[model samples]
Target: MEHIEPVISVKGLSFRYRMSETVILNDISFDIFPGELVGIVGASGSGKSTLCLCLKGLIPHAIHGEMNGDIWVLGQNTREVPTEKLAVDVGMVFQDPESQIIGLTVIEDLAFGPENLEHPPEEILNRMLPILDKVKLQGFLNRETYKMSGGQKQRLAIANALMMQPKVLILDEPTSELDPIGKEEVYSTILELKKNGVTVVLVDHAIEEMAEIADRILVIEEGKLKYDDTPKNHFQSPEKFLEKGWLRIPQIAEALHALKGKDLLSEKYVTPFEEEAISTLSAWLGRESNVQFTVD
Candidate 1:
């Protein structure tokens, strides 16, 4: 079977601001399939945002930068395509939801994209309503954007981006400012997008949450791709990754790391939170004869 072309492809990518000598991204390369939900995780200055910016043609076009590489989004070479043109192919949601809102009312903001394409006004109306429903922001259509809560604002941001009907969506720390409920809402929205066949590239430091949603995880440290693997493997062997000191591991995994020497604990290392709790209870219940506790 022939392989279908990727939605986003990067090769030999490197970038540096005109004012700075340091390169933010090294010779990085990767590809995103049509419907895969991938997460890029790293420290503050690890170039997660920079790499994401490049996917949407924001690095060299919007920001003055020395860029050396090739990036293709929706089959168009990012280097040759204008940012405004790429906007139709790839949509981006930044860390701050407030920065994305523009029009006074939610419906108008959502309508902005299709209208620009000179789509028939009725057709724009047809597209806008469903997107509003998809994001569950229909009630806010006539309401003022400023009056909405932070979570509502973020959903509005997503609604606006979806209004464009882009094939790829790039989100940077999308849930960083959201509360627990808000974060869960955003994650559910992402899963919905994936189900609708949208390619999602999520950049955030929440490894556990990302692991639950992402099909693959790419680790970037000091502006380079360090480790790219399945979330299960990354967490299953904590010490191995900790030795690299690049990727972030879950807290439970870290606890398991420190318990490696406690023969019984090491024998049944847990993966997820529920698994850990059950394992601990089983060991303490005296179900296993070899299990024993000691004080140092």
Candidate 2:
């Protein structure tokens, strides 16, 4: 792989709510490259959301916190840049869709960010269609925000963030409140955003979906950056994370892991996706019953 330059870099970052408060992040540091979809998971109150806030310059700036170390986003120091300026480069969507949705109409919601930055009407209009298409909200541009379903509202919130065309997008538990179908819609949109070279930081409990979408996983434990590796490796060593009381790999991957590198299956199956695991098992069994196993 070619050396991709990091778009965001954190140097020895640590933060706490106040002098008397316990540290939420403890000397955490990492680099996020352009177009990378990074997934963060941990037990609740492990400083995951605080990390997101730090990335977007909310730490020690808008939110009063005792912060140490530096964060550089888009080649600019986040500590130096104003929150308004950082907002332009890093688009953030909170866990709750309703909290972010301010406009009565979809068009108004989508245009909210741009209008704040004082983007002209024509320029905003030109950007609308493309963004609407990106999130699959094309025909509902004029629909009422409250009338939309949980999924639609979530996508609309994402669309609102995309209106700025920010370099980085951070989402906190985007699908926590959505139904299964709503989760699928939001997950699909996240995958599409990765394809478009948008750096995304997702804090979610959907480990299965993370296996499908995240290029790399960042596991946090007690306000520390514990594991940073490809999802493949992360799932392969579930025992380590489990021992630390961090997170478990997807169920599908756990099933495959039990059979991985075993002669019982013709192929060494270690994927986390459900459909892929099923297919791999079927093919292996077919090879055993029908004919001799031939290496692909």
Number of the top lDDT candidate: 2
The count of backbone overlaps in candidate 2 is: 0
Per-residue lDDT of model 1, residues 83-176, tens digit only:
9999987899977889889889987777788888888888887888877786667766799988988878888888788878778999989887
Q: Per-residue lDDT of 127-170 in model 2, one digit per residue for the tens?
A: 99887886778899789999998878888888888888888999
- Overall lDDT per candidate, in order of appearance: 0.81, 0.84
| TM per prediction | 0.85, 0.87
TM-score of 1: 0.85
**Top candidate by TM-score:** 2
